[model samples]
Target chain A: MATQSFKTYFGRNSRQGLWYVPLLITVVGAVILTVYTDDFASPQNLSNLLSQAMPLIIVAIGQMIVIVIGGMDLSVGAIISLTTALLALDAPAFVLVPAVFAITALIGLVNGYSIVKLNVHPIIATLSVQFIVVGFARILRPVAGGSVPDIVVSCVAGTVFGIPLTVFWAVIVLLLGWKLIHGSRYGLHLFAIGGGVSSGQEDAAHNFGISDQRNVILAYVCSALFAALAGFYIAGRISSGDPGVGETFALDSVTAVAIGGTQLSGGIGSLHGTLFGAILMVLLSNGMNLANLSAFLQGAIKGAILLLVVSLQSRKKMGL
Target chain B: MGAIAANPVLQRAIRVPPAYLVFAVLLITLWVTKPQLMNVNVMGIFIRQVAPLGILVLGQLLVMRVRSIDLSGAGVLLVVNYMISSGIMGDVPAIAYIAMALSVGLAVGLVNGYLVGRRRVSAVIATLAVTVILTGIIQFLASGKPPGDMPGYFNDIYNTKIWIVPTPVAFWLLLTVLMSLFLSRFVFGRFIAAIGENPTASHFSGVPVERTVIASHILASVIASVAALVQSASVAVGSIRLGLEMPIDAVAATILGGVIFGRGDGGVWGPFFGVMCFALLFVVMTSFGVPDPGKQIARGLIILLAAIFYGLSSSEK
Candidate 1:
């Protein structure tokens, strides 16, 4: 009876004990870094690491929202590419930034329409959209040039009361994203839809609720918006846009989401877990570089870790 | 009956694929625009280049029919290509080299099959992870340098022609014919069809569900290895990179051949013709002097079209 109760409490669906693994990964990474590099303990090193993590963190946040709705948005990479291209354009910042954001949202809307109205699987639909958007980005800007103003870069790179400006902005985005996902009626529907669409629809019908179309749209919009934000940060980091910048974002974002304890089948994950996953990934990359590991071996290691985390989550889901 | 047979829509539905139709239209258009593009030799050469992709698609379609995918083609290609050019065999006879390469491929296939079929990992994720690991192993082994030369025998085989057609193209067609016979005539083929249509029902009927799936993956990976060999022989050297476009292209072409996830009754020959369509597409594009970036865009659009087509078909079903 005691074992049964203990199993019940610690079993797969429980969220209370979820923070342990991610926190462990983070602590282990930091300790290993400190041990390996003398400069790793310095404030500069920590700040630099956060800055490096900024883009992926933003993308992961967006990816988590989509995953929560039981779908993936592979088009996030294309959004990043498009936004980066927009940033590199010679147009004024006010025009360029807002236009890029709007364009990204529009692309998300198209994705939502195809998935919701046309009843397409998220993976295939988003993957196709990714291709189209990437094609457009290439056609529009074949060359990877143009620049972000130094002033804007300095502001993003600057610190507010010893906290990085990017960190502050990231916090705001995180809060807004969390509230939108966890607090709203839309959030409830998103989770429901992911759990099972037929039952979800029945539940919504009973409650005098509307279709989850709006939630789907919001999720994709958030994904594209966050991807664009990451693009802007990337622009600031490089002070220019390159088509190749987004080539790795799609795979890495998926990896981050998976490692975050989010089920690829959807509806069983958290932003906090995702944040942990992203940090773990960045730390692994940093550690690999520090250890002078070959890029291919690093890739192998990352893939192994991702496979392990996902398998653990899946096994738990399967009640194994 | 003759008029009905000649009707365009019936012709389309009964005859090969719309991709072939498009390929035909484009080929003719190019020929009319530039008569210089109508050489038989040029067309044969172009068809020969895409033979590897054609072979890979057979494996892809087989697995996809069972509601699985194999994106590990690129990794298999990388490793196999590397082995051929690495001089690892070091003066071993050609048959020995061939045997070793196929074994490596079959080993990889076995691993993928176990993970996906037995462990019940998501097909996309499992195959993709396999691909990543294989690619990494190849890259790690190769380090940063270009790979060494393929064996003289590999080059010799690649360069061989029977009559006017390339040996690889002939091999590709022979494999397709054999696969068609297996899928259409054999008991295992029937079992595959049954399993693909509905796994649970097939299992209840004692169709050896797990074994069928595992074998399908094994066959798919072996085909990919063959593709890698042909690809390496054609290039005469292996590099860190080879055929990243292949798995996705295989997906696209399979769909274009009307072999979507749920419906593959269109059979193996349809995708065989789809490979010809891709071959023709490259011919048309090159004839028009379309640049590399333009080719990229075209490929992207084709993939999108396949996805959209898949969406349309599935929703209707």
Candidate 2:
């Protein structure tokens, strides 16, 4: 957390500077917003910021996993919507929150099956899931429904030492993700599969005693779980099961993962970067909001930022 | 069983694309269950609804043929719709509106082409960014209020009928036929096929791979402009949210037509039928009293089915 550590960490004028772009953005965005308004940069305000960004961070973690596996999921947002709808319709009654998570994992399993077993393109397969899941959500609740259970609400919004419990949830994801990805052979296999995405890297990993398909499937299942959790968080925040809450998450999560310096082409990046990337995205929009920019203009700014960041990162990869 | 599986003629017939089969099934189902629904007047009106999608598929197929995609059609359609309907051009003549609308497509398409083809950006990211930018620009301009109505002349063209078929449907069919013919007869079509088969090999063979990609994007946009005009005219009023579904629908239809990225075994008419399948799906859903959400579910299933079909075909190859 010190500038002294940063000095040795990323030397000036390094070719690998793209890896630090998201971190730089987070710093710059925070500074600019803090300068613009006294409300920003405060501990409470920062806590509020983390709470607001918690769901996307969780969702982006899932996305980051999928990207590490050399694929994408257009359905994560819809999965969130579907799970929330399940909770809205049956929570405190028929379907439990655990059941919602189960259903979401099942959906993710289906997505993985289609891609790995059925040989469907990841984009196409997940897109179909997106549509089906979103449609199912609408069917479950044609309109936003009743509030979530009180326990569910407190579980996310509750505080630990004046910080949102949601922050702890995000931290758990990051910490667990790090161990799962970096500390174990499974992570190594995942990165290997990503390195040879669609080129039979699975076979290579298989020779390494890693069940490639299972890992791919696990990545998807993890993503769906987080998305469903995001739905839980959103349902708590809004106090309703609005099927439309996740309209922006699909692209936004992918954008976060991409900006975090994860290779869209696979075989690069870290959970830490994705975590920072999600914060940067959320902070960018939050800063724009504090600036009192029009909602329309804010959208343009976010879009431009996403486009600019990704292109820059990709350009670096191309040695441009 | 071996003979049945291996018979060349039977195999050829089976390979004639699934969209046609879906169309036939829907038509027969309607004939048996609700003959009254099959009448030209009833079908014509519904078919008109998909004419824009049919046209958009033309462009979708072209770029997709070059191993790239253009989701920016939705963006192009949005900007053109806003321009023609918002009266931003202020009472321009109909032809002038047409020109302006197409120019928007050309402009957006060119940017998409340059980024994807020249700058080597991923087609999905580049085109997706273009859509984001256009949406932002329009949202900024509208500033939260609903846009105004389009000209009466546009609506008149939308609803017009020529000899039992709606004008839009006729236009759609003509475009389909012309595109099919063009792909068969033109040099650019050969270029598209070459680039799609293998960009590096095609380039080494002097196929002008990069230019073909950029040209395909430009052409796709021009075709998308026509679709936008048809769509804007259909709604009659300038609406803020329109044409977002076209990109997905266009991709689905193209895939349903057996036109995977960089491959097109299902010629243009196959996708024309793909468009009709959507039209027919609506009729079937409507007759069954399936609501909007149900229709959405059906659409998703079709896309999934198309993906499954693409997977099967690609692996078989």
Per-residue lDDT of B100-193 in model 1, one digit per residue for the tens? Answer: 7699779989987877777766666677777777777778888868788877777798888889888999899898999899888988788877
Model 1: chain A TM-score against the true structure = 0.87
- Tell me the spans in candidate 1 whose CA falls farther than 4 Å from its real position: A1-11, A15-19, A140-143, A150-155, A197-210, A315-320, B1-17
User: Which of the numbered candidates is closest to the native, going by highest TM-score?
Assistant: 2
Docking class of 2: medium
Question: For residues A1-320, could you state the per-residue lDDT of candidate 2 as single tens digits?
Answer: 68766653365532122457788878887888888788787888988888888889889988888987778888999988887778776447335787898899998998998888777878878888898899899998899877677777777777888767877887787787788777788787778887666343446666767788888998888888889888888877776787888978988998888888787767676777788889988887887776688877777777777677666544311100
What is the Cα root-mean-square deviation between model 2 and the actual structure? 3.5
List runs of model 2 lying over 4 Å from the truth.
A1-17, A93-95, A161-163, A198-210, A315-320, B1-14
Separately for all candidates shown, the number of backbone clashes (residues 3 or more apart, or on different chains) is 0, 0
Model 2 Cα shift for residue A237 (angstroms)? 2.1
Q: What DockQ does each candidate score versus the true complex, computed on alpha carbons?
A: 0.35, 0.50
